[model samples]
Target chain A: MRSKASPVSDRSKGQAGWGLKSAAWFGVLYLNLPILFIILYGFTTDDASYSFPPPGLTTQWFAVTWARADFWEALWLSVQVAFASMLIAMVLGTFAAAAMYRFKFFGKEAVTLLILLPIALPGIVTGISLRSAFSLGDVPFSYFTIVLGHATFCIVVVYNNAIARLRRSSPALIEASMDLGADTFQTFRHVILPNLATALLAGGMLAFALSFDEIIVTTFTAGQQETLPIWMFGELSRPRQRPVTNVAAIFVMIITFVPILAAYYLTRDTDDVAGSGK
Target chain B: MTTTGAARPRSLSNSFSTFLYQRPRLVLALLLVPPLLWLGIIYLGSLFTLLAQSFFSIDDFTAQTIYEPTLATYARLFTATNLSIIFRTLAMASVVTVISGIIAFPLAYYIARFASGRMKALFYVAVMLPLWSNYLVRVYAWKLILAKEGAIHWSINSLGLGPVLDWILTLPVVEGSSLSTSYIGTTLTFVYIWLPFMVLPIQAALERVPRSLLEASSDLGARPNETFRKVIFPLAIPGIAAGSIFTFSLTLGDYIIPQLIGSSRPFIGQAVYQFQGTAGDIPMAAAFAMVPIVIMAIYLAIAKRLGAFDAL
Candidate 1:
């Protein structure tokens, strides 16, 4: 009578099924609540204090954020940085993956580690280091420095995606092209490029999304220059500008959100997404 | 295929392709050089430069960093205030990491083993969507949530849990600051910001666990609890470890959450920023920055030993 036995199933089917589902939903809700706040607050008629229930809903702040020249300038700077970083990342990342994947190389592991280092290390470390290098070398903080800082991590995104895609692709596809008397460049253009196109694009979109919203590294690299995030960070200190700031933040969310969504859809069929570690 | 009667217009491309084919090593070099130069010279070079700068000390009198090699700046990091900040930051990161791990594991397990294909994709998107949102505003939203007149306190009071919430708020390290102005607030914000980073890798790891093994354990008379402890936990440790890398490191390095939520106590990131930006003490900032670097290096090393790199 004192023996405790369990009617245990091997499948994790009925073990706290409803409880776990609700817990999972709770996790998702927890993750999105702040974002929901951003969206909600953006429409608030109140501009100063963040009341729990925003007094009223208005699209006035969106218009205000859009009308501000400063907002456009910051948005433009962010776009430039994101675009430049994505281009640099795509080219370098795709090439690095192709080279390392195709050829036998010495110190390959070291190379991989080096590529991963910027992202693997803390962003503040990268930020401070870039600042140090700039000051020492008499390099001014400019768009170039910002892009360079972004490219470090953005390249890794592309590299991870490309390498995973390359590894998964059949070597025989390239071999078939070569066997048919096609040259290396021709084979690559015909077989390899087609295979890697979506992955690299997905990677680039992800990289672009990252660069667009990057705050920590951009904070150090952008001197007297305000990217959208930098501008938003500045806005946080201004108490009167709460609605405007929320509106701008909402704008950024909607902008970067698209690329991220596109990147997800593009990589969904693939077994591994770069930063996703899947 | 026409042998000798190939189109004359394709000659340039054919020759170029042939030229590339004849020199595979040259092609490899061409492909490898540009990216290597960019990452190696620009990124790693900057890091080395930062490390070298950490050896220099700032002169308060001249307000310039002395170019001489000295560990004085590194030694400067041992002050009571700085050490307190470091300890607070480390404690916060540890708590956040543990909480995130606990919360994320079940959610990840559910997504991996239970969710349908459509549901899995939705969960993945949910996990990553927050990562793309503007980070600063997210912290600000938490500021509102934890404010005295905000949703949390309001709900707590309305739900008859006011005293309970107050008692918890008055507990150690968070006394008198209210929810919005305390380390509790900071830790909450950091955990919220970084929770997504905790979910994906763990989900991937759980997904990779073979179903046959679970059936095998059951067949061997092992209960679900025993199976989880003996098999699932050990295998999933690496994924948990990997997830922790992002949560730990991101929390360790973040300055914004502390600024927006916590009282005026400085964390490592804020200290570094203030030292460099406001105080013009680059060397001291560099030295302070090394705390996180050293911590993450050790963390990564341990994680690597645990096979977290495999998950990555």
Candidate 2:
């Protein structure tokens, strides 16, 4: 009798366990359904209107999309912008973080606040302001301007990451190095750089991801040029490019997901790195 | 822990040697100059330009700038239509923030308190994935979901509730006869897009609430609700404020969702876009951008007063 009762209770527990599992599965599916639809429709024959259960399955859109030179060109431009902006962000952000970390300068707090302002402000504000400034300076919208505009906000991400990592580091290490024979450059290269390498790489990846998907700022700064997002925006607005646009969007989703996932993994072990200032 | 007195100069030569030892600081400062100059020339200078542009007006007939200082654009911003647009934008932003806050609090609590190490990391990654995808793609995906013959409508109809769904669709509360181009659609998209911002900060705050503190409260015979209200809520207010800043400011300045989903109504973002894109009125666009700046400034000031600058 005791054994039977235990079995009955175990069966009930099993049913309840399955119930929770199904619910969780359904929730995650609902969250990702839009992305699923985009991927599914990429292989569909319906070009005029996107139907829920796509009318017919076809892969011809992929071929057409691949054949288009404009697609490749836009993708290349986006890659260039993301890379350029990431490099600028890494160098600038590392130096700024080091300066603010090491010094007791006048207006330190004020300067830090100013550095964060562009990011905290709405992207539209940054976009419009940069556009206006570019026009005033008679700097025609080009790849350089786009990279410059992106770096303004991208630096904030890298700076935040680098500064957080710097804070996690013990000042005692540097002091100990100096107390020994090592000079400043030697100590930084040996001690600080190794400590910061993971964080800097993670920050750079994150900055690149942001620059890749950024549209509002790019829109104001790109002018007639088409980066991947800008090109997708145009494709989405027009009726003829719906299928091709879906393909392009899938491409973007894949590129963005990988780096961001890597970044999350790199930073996950260092939770205190995020809120160390407190 | 060495004080400045411990490092007091034994002689002028020792002081000079110390300066040479600290030369990396100077090099770091020098390396910082280029980026600082970039910010000053590009970001800060553009804000000055935006402020100056607002003083000029657009010519009515030709849609060209008059280039003369005037308050006419400010005067027009006060008109009934524009004021209503501003109010609607604010209302939408507030609604999104509140809805996201409510949903995020429970999820964030569950993850922070219940999940183990690996599960917690996976959940965090899931939350941030949507943020990395293209903004335009996300908005467009929402558009497809809310379209007349879309999955939402199809699912509702298939569930033997077609009449009820049809009636709701025909209501005046919806801007259009369909769901695609309406305020409801726009609000939903904003909530989904900004939800991650709300979750991350709240999770960070909740994680800081030590498990021992909760156990101690329970050991003292306090109920869970009592402990949550008395202990947890106060600690998490700063995180709530930071999350609200991101959600509110992002929603207010977003023109893309409104363009894609909003039918006839124009939010401030759309208004600014139109001034630049369609009307070619840069001054009017600059004036429109000031609305969010003022609101954000007030928010930042309050945040500073709360000593929440570090929260950001």
Candidate 3:
């Protein structure tokens, strides 16, 4: 859609110099080298050290990680937290988007700012604030606290995607539904939901990915409870657990990678909406 | 789409929907209240509590927080050692933001202008994967890569550039036993971690730039460099600023990378964590936490003035 806007500029396409391409590749290498090393070390035969050019490769760590009860527990806890957070975010984010889209209100800018604050501010502030808030309220640090912490930021992810998609979708679709004598529930169920499905799915997946791998906020909110990232942190502190930690890192990468990829594809063609560009 | 039976009698849900339809204000309230209760009351209330806590002082003998408001904690924050931690974190955040912008620009430009169709999606996913990869693992990977007997050291030695690395490591402020123990290593890790945050926004902003604008620039007697300077660069500023917000604030508040990989000197985050966790001085930690908040508030104000939030 963009490239077709001006054919003259299209002539200049593919003219990116070798320097720029190599620079981009360098950026790619910079991003992935550490990740590659994580995978490499996961298969490393030596367990005690990160000696480069590992003496040999083996599958021992995978078996060891599989047998570890704590690893499984952490992974389960992370999954539950991510799912809960994502669900809360999806519900509240959708409501926020609907209100903002359908009505005019004073202090809307302030509300938007408030919504964005959790993510816009540093994680440390959110962590410590939530920690203090819970303690002051005499609330114990538990699964619920971690989910609450995760949901605050996760809401922003879903809200951004939902609002963007709402803006892209035409209001006429709802008007038409109403004109055809559909009630609010029917219009929402039949019209608004279909338009929002992919956006919500993408947002939910991103939210899950975020809550799954989150460490900083989890540190404050989780009391004696290990999420996968926190588990990885503990493992990193122990030299003997290096290989097993790397294997767990591989598990995290695969878990998050799938959702992120799904989100990318779900949102890639969002311009092609059911009632857009009308 | 499935059409409902028009002859069917209206159900309870339909009548309730009708009631809501007649009251748009009610509908709006219903839509807004839940999210507002969470964000406004819960999240903002917590923040307010933290700010209020910062104003209170801790008792030395009892090790308990005195409810009375005072600036003593803020005063404690300015002691020489504490001030150094503040400065160190600010310095690192600034440097990381700058370096991330430099490295992210060309790659973002390539993705924005050159890559198309499947290639574009591939590049986009490639950049995004690292961001979603476990944050702890990425930092730990860098720790291994920068360790004394790590991959970088081994590679440098294999290339017979061992002396060069050693020489580089021995430089004034950056000097340490190895890369992993220096500010340089921490800075590098910070850049790698935040690079994707910098790239994505720039790419989005650049993608939104209509090709016709570039055609107009070229047709208006502007050279390639002039067109880039006057048009492309100006359009990308919002994105760069937005990206800097993440890179700067994240680095400023992060305690983990420094804890695992850098010099033993504490950053603001480590200070906050330790003051609150080990020292059990909540007042001190709250006061220290305000440093990044204050810095970011100023940073965000400027970025907002530059229309960075639109890019975000």
Candidate 4:
């Protein structure tokens, strides 16, 4: 009987059995192969076409990418858009989350639902709608339009994190600050801000990463502006310097990956970030 | 209590803070209004306007939009070509969703039940890192891998399986296409890109299933297989539902993968993009966009009923 209970405790252990582990390994490998292949092909000397084992390898593609003015402009634009959208999302999403968490108001559920809708709906739906609205309003397609499109979804990411953190932190903390002579701004600046600092950071990073890699929404809203991903899309189909594009792809992988890793570390212990979902 | 505060006047910001603190409702209103207006009015307003545009028709001769409210744009949707695009997209999305679900479940189950904390975190990274990486690059990589002169065929030839590779390429639906140039490649890439969505939700659901329940079933003289069938599988359905939502919706909305990897025929996303960008037909694009919106709305409603929201 004692032995049976012990086995049950070990039921969920890593060494539980081999079949489960092998199946899980296959799943992980399948997910990663494409990414790994991109990195591998980035080093290939065959620029005209991809071959499984490269005829040769060289470091020239990276240098070629470095010398491209268009790549730099696209990268810079993506950074600006990512930062702008992250700032907007952090401010608006944090405010909404803090307000919704602290006070119960009418139509609060509706407000939350509304925030979620942009991300919840298909990107094409959000994309065309914004494009239609822009054209209808006679707003020119520009950088501002792209930021607005990215911000719609970015706000949801920040709100999810901020609201989750706010819900978990006690109301007594805020009340006590006011009780101790801290005014509203001080209470928020001290108690609320500290409580929210990591979530906000996590949220902002995730939002930045999202905005950086965003395509569908940006496609409709970007007008003639080409963010890095948009540039990658065009270049893939009509690629002149193919390996340079792969090198640019490698660059994108690095840019988006760093923020995502940072966000993951910041929020790993808490399931508050938008895509964590569980 | 400050030395300069014999009878100091409060700063404007401090006074304002005090005032705001005194009225929580007012504070909430101030905090809430900006985001609400941004999302509600700006976003939903744009959406409503889009829906309105979908009902209008475009004038071909004038190259202008006719603003009168009508169902003329939607009427264009049932044209044989448009319907084929819609059906192709629907079939691909379902195929991707089902394939991803089947692959993800056992993997998620293993991570949820069998792995240690460190191993689980590693698996989470494995699942999420690709999702965070560039979407286009992944598709491009698959395009190369499935190319006629690419890795899969190369491997097949080296292994002395030359005829088998040719046979696959010559298969009826793929006669004019290789792996990278057909609907099959599109489905495979879609599944690859969206697999994390399936894995994470299912993992979350699996983790929530209690060991005690499994133990109870087995203690009652049930076999492990019986315990799993009766208890474990049913509990994980919502997670699978939640995951399917992402895979299905993403596949439906995606234009890039289809355009990059497949042949000339357009999916809903590509058609919408082309109509709006190339043809300068916003009304038609808006109408095409509505297909996914209507499908997703219905799908989400069903998902909510299946307890998917709880998992999310």
Top model number, DockQ = 3
In model 4, where do residues sit more than 4 Å from their true spots? A1-14, A175-181, A270-278, B1-18
User: Residue-wise lDDT of candidate 4 within A166-217, one digit each (tens)?
Assistant: 8777777777777776767788789888768998998999899999989989
Candidate 3 TM-score, true structure as reference = 0.96
User: Model 2: which residue pairs collide?
Assistant: none
Question: What local lDDT score does residue B126 receive in model 1, on the 0 to 100 scale?
Answer: 85
User: CA lDDT of A61 in candidate 3?
Assistant: 89
* Model 1, span A117-219: residue lDDT tens: 8887878889989988998999999999999999888999999889988888777777777778776677878888887888999999989988998889999
Per-residue lDDT over B27-80 for candidate 1, one digit per residue giving the tens place of the 0 to 100 score: 899999999899889888988898888999999899988999998998888999
True contacts kept of each: 0.70, 0.47, 0.80, 0.77
- Provide the TM-score for each candidate, comma-separated: 0.93, 0.89, 0.96, 0.93
Cα lDDT of model 2 by residue, A115-191, tens digit: 89887889999999888778867998999999999999999888888998888877877777767645556687888
Score chain A of model 2 by TM-score against the reference chain A: 0.85
Candidate 2, which segments miss by more than 4 Å at Cα?
Answer: A1-31, A270-278, B1-28, B61-63, B303-308
Error (Å) of candidate 1 at residue B245 is 1.3
The most accurate candidate by lDDT is 3
Candidate 3: tens digits of C-alpha lDDT, residues A155-181: 999999999999988888889988888
Model 4: lDDT of residue B143: 86
Expressed as tens digits, the lDDT of each residue in B168-228 for candidate 2 is 6667856465577776778778887887788778878877886667768878999977988
